[model samples]
Target: MSEVRSEEEKAAEARRGPRRGPGPGGHAMGSGEKASDFRGTIKRLVGLLRPERALVTIAIVLGTISVVLGAVGPKVLGWATDWIFAGIIGKQLPAGVSKDQLVASLRAQGDNQKADLLSGIGHLVPGQGINFTEVGRICLLVLALYAVASLLSWLMSYLLTGSINRVIYGLRRDVEHKLGRLPLSYFDRQPRGELLSRVTNDIDNVAQSLQQTLSQLLTAALTVVAMLIMMVTVSPLLSLIAVLTIPVSIAITAVIGKRSQALFKEQWKSTGELNAIVEETFTGHELVKVFGRRAETEAEFARKNDQLVEAGFGAQFISGLIMPMMGLVGNLNYVLVCVVGGLRVTGGSMSLGDVQAFIQYSRQFTQPISQVASMANLLQSGAASAERVFEVLDAGEQVPDPATPGRLGGRTEGRVAFEDVSFSYSPDKPLIEGLDLVVEPGHTVAIVGPTGAGKTTLVNLLMRFYEIDAGRITLDGVDIRDLTRHELRDQVGMVLQDTWLFNGTIRDNIAYGRPGASEEDIRQAATSAYVDRFVHSLPDGYDTVVDGDGGSLSAGEKQLLTIARAFLSEPSLLILDEATSSVDTRTELLIQKAMTDLRTDRTSFVIAHRLSTIRDADTIVVMEDGRIVEQGSHDQLVDAGGAYARLYRAQFAGAAVDIEAQDGMASVS
Candidate 1:
């Protein structure tokens, strides 16, 4: 176990995620972004669009059709108005009998054919009079067209919501998969709050904005183009007047977009920071209460809350200005068009029908621009959220898995070796250096150290949670770097000092690492770990939910569940960190017996304070200040009179009653 490798090579094989932009200690951690960041965000959004191609196609087609329906209604109404004026007031009815004769003729036709006759006249027969009766009929027809348009628009909203959510669901699934495959060190730099923000809040923002905001923007843009062409066709002078309003409105939108985008980015960051504070404080609630730091916690939370408020206000302040500004400009453009078109009407340069159609077209022009302006806040919010999501996607992945992962089909031998292994969580801070060790198959080795003494770090390296700075680790004489992470971890079992049981049943937690375990296997494993008896005593037995850190169970019971988990895996190599430390005298003795049964025929690395547990270990490596200070068997170390001897004697001098209890670490559990 002494093959040395350089820092670069170690980092390449390490399970820790790649470090990007420099962070504290010159290690890269994502912090925040600059204003120019949104450009990259837009590019990323374009990529996300490819997956939703079908939805996009449907939205585009339906949106255009929906807008056409809207424009057609007003134009139809204007045409019917012309027919009414000629038939009722102008006496210009198309050389037919008086208005009364036309009404009587229409009345003689059944209501069914009133529609048919109206349709016939709508075909523009030259000699036919469009009497008041026909004009009134057409007005009802215009309303019917608009009713259908409104229904289609509502349908489009639902389709847009579905399209966006489907994309979001796909993204969330990918992220969950990535999290399980990502290295442990990836979690080290990332506070749980920040990662949660990415998985939950940021992703939700992407979906929500796509549903209500982005789709509307797309609709508005398409509508504006369609309506502008309609306006120019109706009358170029009026179209020109309406088009002038677009540039200034867009410029205002741009300015507000920048300010709100920045504010929104800050808001997301602040949200992560605030979440981190909550998680940290709540997790360490015991320590905080003991120290009476409630006021301090409150002050910190208030500060974060205040910052969040300021950011929200700033973003809202800018984006909120767009709609009123759009309205004022649109209103001004409408008045101007009316004045110019009215002059043309009086001069007989344009027909009254043309002037009326121009007015309708002008409103259509402003409608899209105004609608787009209204969605500005949500657009900026989406951009801010997009940048956050991309940050994770762009952090670079853990070392790529092999094309065909090499699997050891059978139970792997437990032989282990470490070769000149050195490591550092960050470049400037080294945790272990040139560590070398060899444990033959089925040997139990105990590692001892003070706080931060790197004993846990040793187990971390063996598990490939973080890559060693130099050298390599191996199992059965094969370098672990060449092994698939999943394959390597499958043969190894770890029971952390702090056992984590997900929101699941006790039986489920026990069988988590070995899902195919039968109920008998679970019970036998728990029995050997001394947990079966306790479980049998509970009202629900193994079926009970272990929620809130298994608060329902005692510390000893929780540790036993973890031990059962490790046993169920039947791991070739086991790392138990202070396994029996958190138990009463009786519980510790029971655990000791359970541990003895599990240790035979398995290579185990243990970190425990009770020297008695290691008395039978094949080897004992004692650490002080991050270095191994002693190495030998338990008896040999007791005789050496070094750090191990001092610690041993100190514990040995305690009453045998207290030594047997060995329950000091229970509260920590």
Candidate 2:
């Protein structure tokens, strides 16, 4: 019994954590954890895009065409510049003088440099002014190229948006499905707020990051490549200068990105922890106030908020360095290109028009690099969120149902039998061992025990909420595991100590037990469970609205509603775990009467700490240390003077003293 209590205490402590807080010593949960595999997480994120691969491929093609056309525009515009310059110089020279004759005269006049400079302008018509027709044609051609590029770029963005949204939609759906498949134990270990962060906040961040970065990064990459090729075609020297900045830019990105990746991971982890704290605080706000721990709770929230702030600041600040550093490198490359191209043009080896185009190519090349660098922080943040989401998706699921499930045959008799069952929450601490019990159809078995005597665990095992480590539990001669979970659970109805009601009308909440149940049947169950008494006082009667917390309803009233819900189910087997714990004396009496009527011809298992409630049970089983120590009618156990007798004596003795005090006070008055 000591071991059982100790194990139960440990489990409770795990759920509550230290000081009833989010983590050890009230720290954030998993705050120190880091992503184990950054590259692997990125690969998995890319895999999510695989379903829209065809759309993505088309988008990529369009982006490439857009970038290529944009890149070619500068080189084509260079032709117009050359033509304008040629006409300007030609208008200054003597008309009727051929370009060769002028160059020869200049060389003969001992001006070889001038002659060579004039020799390179092949399109120059000596003595003619600028040609408006040719320049206008070139301008129109450049305009057309830019217009087409813009249209293609817009189409590419549209395609990417569609693909990204579809992928995110599927991701959210998978997360929802994954949650359904997870074992109860997983939820026991995880904080509700932290899990919500992963499902909502983290997934939203992933979607936003993908949406903001995917198309931009693709366009930036192709722009860099196309621009480089155009630069090389115009002037190899300038292209080399631009290319040299690549290594430096990569170095900057690598160094800053490595540090920011860790920070981003910390930022998201802290975000989840902070969310957990807020959720826990809000969910238990009344309890926190009742205990007067508002200051302490606020202090904890502040501490977590501080951690998140520090992490977010560090992540953004470090990533922000990439843009300016790349810009500096780009400017230096630009200066080098300008100086070298100027010297080459003066020496008649390169034309001014080509130099002008090369400069534009150089600028275009660096712009994409800068753009990619600027998005590093978003990419890292998204990757961190994706890793967190993948953790949930990759979590081990509960044991699956049988492929070919066994049937209970027609009309289940609710003959539940535990055959040499053994189970434990932990391997080293056995809670129940070789436990055998059988309840026939139409029998009401009441279970009584101390707080940690495996009473509820037994019911949980029977429901297959937690599978037994050994042996089989059967219903109607068929092993429960052989039946599908849904099939097995459908035959059972349970009313727990804690009541749950969703935000809906009273009638809707009751009808939740048996969907599509007729309105008349719902009211009949509510009347039988005694919920109709108070519900009739309300203006809306069964149409009155209530939330999951049973807003404005008294505890006893909420408990009655849950009871009414169970009555509507009409299960073959019923399990009531402290069903009357929350009610007053009058309500309790009414519920006992209703339960007696409801138990007719149906097997019922009642777990209770209240000895008075189960005195008339068909069989009272007293449990100690996970084993049945006494089994008989209440009078039979009392006569035997066993564990049950002592419990009965202690309880009634306390009650008798309270009554005597009241009588004495009445006499004195």
Candidate 3:
């Protein structure tokens, strides 16, 4: 009943996907733990950028230069206006006055009305083709600068935008590479779909924010600073009036930006949850339909979707208000500047040009602040993404390989011994308890056990997939765990009950264990596992594409392919965990023969439920619960009347059948 309950609970949890919420217990970052600290993540990502970095760098440089030109152009225009107002309008110069300077200054004015006004204010009659022609030249220069800057800015936009997509590919590749190398236990705590969302959706968000908003923010800030400085130099009072709206704008922006940032974070978190739900439901679609729980699934998904909508709206709503508010506040400041600065100009304290320049400066000042308010949502999204990135980068490393560890070569004879082995998945519950075992070189040892009897767990130990809590497993008298897992696994081969095949050709799958194996070697291994016939029967023979988990083949056929793969690996130690369970009775006979051929020169662990398969095992260990209740040869155990004896009797039923079973033990029927 407890087993049934556990299964039911697992099924239910699997349906819900990774359980998550915006609870207080999340990896919330301090301001100091900025995303910039993700050096490992950055290094890995940069490694993938090797294909496009040169072009990408050129694009970024061009874009940055264009931004500077555009920003500096406005300041130059401000300076031209300031010169006309300050020097020309005041009539008598501050010092070092000359008519050439006076006429040249008018030419540099650029704007006709402004030049004429400054000329009129100057009380000088420096007219004719010479002065007006020079002014035309100055106007032409301003126009040329504007055109060039704007054109490059537009071109840079296209180049950088394309580069952003290229960059995303690099980032995705690096993220995948890192995930592949991470230990399996990492997945035990974090859900697969959630991690996928980080790699895909969250990373995309970060890319978008950096490409779109961050670059613009940098240029906008410089433009604002340039404009403010020009305004202040021209007329401090006028500049003061224009900048009065700044503090108000900043206050409004801060409140909105902060809220938007927080909401966008929630949005990303919710998006991950939404994706997790979709992944969970899709994988369990058959069960969901069979259980008649479609409505419940829809309802659950709806709840998550609504939360996403709320988060998105909250973020966008605050961000959307930025442009309109900035424009409104800026226009209001424009009105104030015109009124006050106009009064000052009429009273001979300033000029019409000064008023015009001050208005331009006001716009320049507010534009960045306004844009940043608009960018608040993007910043928040990026911050959220960076938070996740930092989380992965800052995550603890797995148990590392020891320095100068033993290396296992192909010559390993595969004598394996577990000396007083004990293990636990968690500290509170031990899985294997003092699991002492010895499989002699070139011998087949069968481990028979019920469910939760640590059958597969023992396989995990043999492969060094998990670290043991106590004692040691040795390969050729050297501790397996002391050796790097990669080295240890090099000499061991495992064929799991569930056969997994990649989306590749049959030949590719067969050769994956040994990439350099010749076609003849591949063919021989295929023949040994009895997979050669099946391959020949396929439409494309070895070249047939096995799409999606080898779904084209039967479960038993996939198992045979795995067996063939194991045969190709040709490891010194072999583990057959119910390897033939998926094969038919006829196929099983061939596989049994293949197993005999492979097990001749290597130590093998045979874990099976079929009693007939283990009859010839040099040592048959009958396990109940977690302990080995009894062990011996088939005849010896039957004569001893232990757990193995009772189990044997139950299988063969009578004395005659038992004796017959014992007779065929040397070569399994």
**Mind giving the per-residue lDDT tens digits that candidate 2 earns over 1-669?**
000112333453343344223432233465237554668888889899998999999999999999999999998898898889889889999999899999999999999888878887758889998888988999999999999999999999999999999999999999999998887656656777788899999999999999999999999999998998898888887788889999999999999999999999999999998888888887778888888888998888899999999999999999999999999998999999999998887778888789889999999999999999999999999999999998899888988999999998656899989999998766777778998898899889999877677787788788777789998999998999999888888888888876778999999999988999998999999999999999989879999999888888999999999899889999898888888989976577678879998888888999886754587688888888678888888889999999988988977657646545654665576
Off by over 4 Å in 3: 1-120, 123-131, 147-174, 289-295, 622-627, 634-669
For each candidate, give its TM-score against the true structure. Answer: 0.86, 0.93, 0.79
Question: Candidate 1 at residue 378, lDDT?
Answer: 82
- Which candidate leads the pack in TM-score? 2
Q: What is the lDDT of residue 424 in candidate 2?
A: 77
Query: Where in model 1 is the C-alpha error above 4 Å?
Result: 1-30, 88-130, 140-155, 624-626, 650-669
> Using alpha carbons, what is the TM-score of model 3?
0.79
- lDDT agreement with native, every candidate: 0.75, 0.85, 0.69
Over 4 Å off, model 2: 1-28, 652-669
By summed lDDT, the worst window of 10 consecutive residues in model 3 runs over: 1-10
lDDT of 3 by residue, 1-669 (tens): 000111222322334344342211121112222423233443454454467667656656666666555555655554455545444435444345554466467567754444444443432333311234444555666777778877766775666567667777666776676765565445545655567678778887878776877457656766677677777887888778777888988888777776676677777777877776777677667677888878887887888889889989998988788778888998888888788877675554665655666777777778778888777767667767766765665565556778888766557877788899887665665556887888889989888766566666677667755577889989888888678877777777777665768899988888887779999999999999988888888999888889656757987889888888889988888888788878776677678878888888988888877765687889988776456778888788889987776666665556446545555774564
> What CA RMSD would you report for each candidate?
8.2, 4.1, 7.7
Total clashing residue pairs per candidate?
5, 0, 0
Q: Residue 646 in model 1: shift from native, Å?
A: 3.8
